[model samples]
Target: MADLPNCPICTMPDPLLAADGYECATCGHEWLAAPDDGLDDIRDANGNLLADGDAVSIIKDLKTDGKAGGIKVGTKIKSIRLVPGDHEIEARVDGRQLLIRAAFVKKA
Candidate 1:
């Protein structure tokens, strides 16, 4: 049998490969096959895959509404958290939590 990835939802070792995707034997969960290594679906401005706890730098200046000043280019952010949404990254900048778009950053 071909090497199949474990179930993503249940972490089952034995997942049955189906025509559409994979089905977990233990939890009966179904999910589509991962694209490439599947380390992360998020990518930086340079197309580098971003993982949790990675450091990134802002490529462009971003202005925040109702706040004086803003995030500037080349600002380094460490220990970023990957999130699911329109804003794909979560991090703390200057003691404020910010949700950042992937296109504005590059892996540092």
Candidate 2:
């Protein structure tokens, strides 16, 4: 048997292959498998590719809602974690966890 990919919606590993596409048994989700084209590459503001544990610096000052202060430009962040979703970078700032968009940071 051929190896099947995990469901994109639920992350289930046992999606069954169907005539049209793959179907997730756990979540009842169906999706067509596309070729892996490196579309998920996360790039910084300087167009540098970012990876987990890579250090980065904020390129722009960002405001925090209901917070006393905001992230300043050139603030350094170490050991960044890459996460899925709109905000791709996750790091700790000022003792608080923050989800930052990759566009606001640059490789440091």
Candidate 3:
């Protein structure tokens, strides 16, 4: 069979394939070879790669269109969907679907 993909965490070559996905032998970290949606790599403020369903926190106060008081600093946002763009995070907060910049958030 073809070689398995490298581990995302430790960068170890060839994690073994399993029913769920691949698991790193060195770090024991398990991750899928690619996301189901086929979106490109998504990174956070600290440059940590983000995956779908990742929870992130707003690092600074961000003004939204309708909200009189904008989103507060340290607001926890869950289930973020990464899209393809400069400001490329899709999330729902306070009943509003918002497109947030990755620079303003860190993995929660």
Candidate 4:
């Protein structure tokens, strides 16, 4: 993060490599340098792909709406895709493909 100091609030070490940047590991601070964090490991703390993701998981107790609700942690998910939204995750669960929020799930 050029010109911008790592978040003072969160004293997390940011290892930027020119083109892209991301949040500090210690703190949930995201750094947006001029471009993307080529490292593209931008998963939630749980490691779930942030929508349009390419993996799946059930490592956390996730709450759902409509007919499906209460997905127990450790529920294995597959074919995850990342999306652009608050809960950024697109995967198939219980045979029903839907968009899941990243914060709610973890990597498998």
Relative to the true structure, how large is the alpha-carbon lDDT of every model?
A: 0.90, 0.90, 0.87, 0.61
CA deviation > 4 Å runs, candidate 1: 1-40
- Candidate 4 Cα outliers beyond 4 Å, as residue runs: 1-41, 46-53
Candidate 4: residue 82 lDDT (0-100): 67
Q: Report the lDDT tens digits of candidate 1 across residue range 1-108.
A: 788998888887999888888899999999987755433589999999999999999999999766898899999999999887789899999888999999999999
Return the clash pairs for model 2, or none: none
> What's the TM-score of every candidate structure?
0.64, 0.64, 0.62, 0.48
lDDT of 4 by residue, 16-104 (tens): 33346555555666666554424354476655344443555566676677765667877877667765556566677887777766666
> How many clashes (backbone N, Cα, C below 3 Å) per candidate?
0, 0, 0, 13
In candidate 1, list every pair of residues with a backbone clash: none
Give the higher-lDDT candidate: 2 or 3.
2
Error of 4 at 65 (Å): 2.2
Candidate 1 TM-score versus the reference: 0.64
Candidate 4 has its poorest 10 consecutive residues by lDDT at 33-42
Ranking of candidates on TM-score, top first: 2, 1, 3, 4
lDDT of 2 by residue, 18-102 (tens): 8878999999999887655443799999899999999999999999876877999989999999988788999999888999999
